[model samples]
Target: MTNAKTLGQAFDVLLQPDKFRDYGPNGLQVEGDREVKLLVSGVTASRALIEAAIEAQADAIFVHHGLFWRGQDGRIVGWMRERLRLLLTHGIHLFAYHLPLDAHPELGNNAQLGRLLGWQADGRFGDQDLGFLGVSTQPWSRPQALADHVSAVLSRPVTCVGDMGQQVRRVAWCTGGAQGYFEAAIAQGVDAFITGEISEPQAHLARETGVAFLACGHHATERYGAPAVAARVAQDLGLQHRFIDIDNPA
Candidate 1:
């Protein structure tokens, strides 16, 4: 068992949440028990995940996406109220890290995804250096080959927006709804850009610039960071840890 504040402090030290200007609060969004023995980690703190945590008797829940965000309705009602009620009723602490989790060199989503796909990050690009510039360790000569590899690894159909014959060597990527960074990645002279989602303009841009684009599912790409960080923290703090993957098709 460990003090809840100590766990939070450990995460703050490792992730440095304050360094990123994120869309939502980055740490300890909901307070619960003062002590935590078991930690549950997941991609998002949706109702299903919370219920699973409850079932597992987790004292705290760590996630990449939290219950709250900027520009959202401040009032606690509807789905928000229910989520809050469950946490409060169970006395489960809620901790979330967004951009900080994404940007961490080793434990971040981009880094973990790169490691999973055998890509090497050589540099960073885009806003706050959230996007990664990398090269595939294996020579994926064609866009289709890279897309096929991504699909097989992520277990979800990848959406490719470029000619199959396009030669792909250098690559850039940012996980989770970062299609806006495509042009910035293009400027870096990468042959391909991979992200969790793609927008309409990206298709046109891929055609015009001949830069291949791949949209792996947002939830699929971000599944690693929270669990990886949580497991390390749990090991360091001598607390039990469980990662519950509530599958999300998005």
Candidate 2:
């Protein structure tokens, strides 16, 4: 077993939460056991995930999305109470890393997705440098082909907005509901923009701007980073770890 305090300290050092301004508190959102023997990672700290982790006998749950958003009501009621009740009752530690998990160059959602898609990242842009700007290893002569590749890699159908045969080279991506950053991505002159979620205006923007757009499921795109980081931490601390994937269609 590893001490939760020590593991959290290591995470703070590794992730450096202080570097970014996030929507929610960055680390150790809900404290539980002092010692962690089995650690589980997931995309969000939902009731389903908490119950699954409890069933799996996980001492802690590591996640990309955590409770207590910036503008959310602070009361422990409704869905929040249900989630917290599970964690508290099971004495499971909840550790969340939002922007930090997305921004990490090597193990981040953007980086992992880039690696999976065979994109060569040259730089980062957008808010707190959360967006990745890259070039596809293989020139994409058709938007549909790129969409197919993304769908294959993510195992989820992708919605594309652009000419089917449009050629694309430079690409920009930011995982998890970062459609607002498309403007910044457009400013970068990327031929295509890939993000977790897309707003309605983006369809018009894609058509008018002649830049391709793909809404690749927020949960699907952001699933890799948290588990990778969790596994790394568990390995470092000599604790057993498993990634509990609570599939989200969003």
Residue pairs whose backbone atoms clash in candidate 2: none
Give the Cα-based TM-score of candidate 1 against the true structure.
0.98
lDDT by residue for model 2 over 20-62, one digit each (tens)? 9888898899999558999999999999999999999999989
Q: Each model's C-alpha lDDT?
A: 0.94, 0.90
lDDT of 1 by residue, 1-250 (tens): 7877899999999999888998999989999965899999999999999999999999999999998899999999999999999999999999999999999999999999999999999999999999999988997999989999999999999999877787888999999999999999999999999999988899999988889999999999999999999999999999999999999999
TM-score, one value per model: 0.98, 0.97
lDDT of 2: 0.90
C-alpha lDDT of residue 187 in model 2: 97
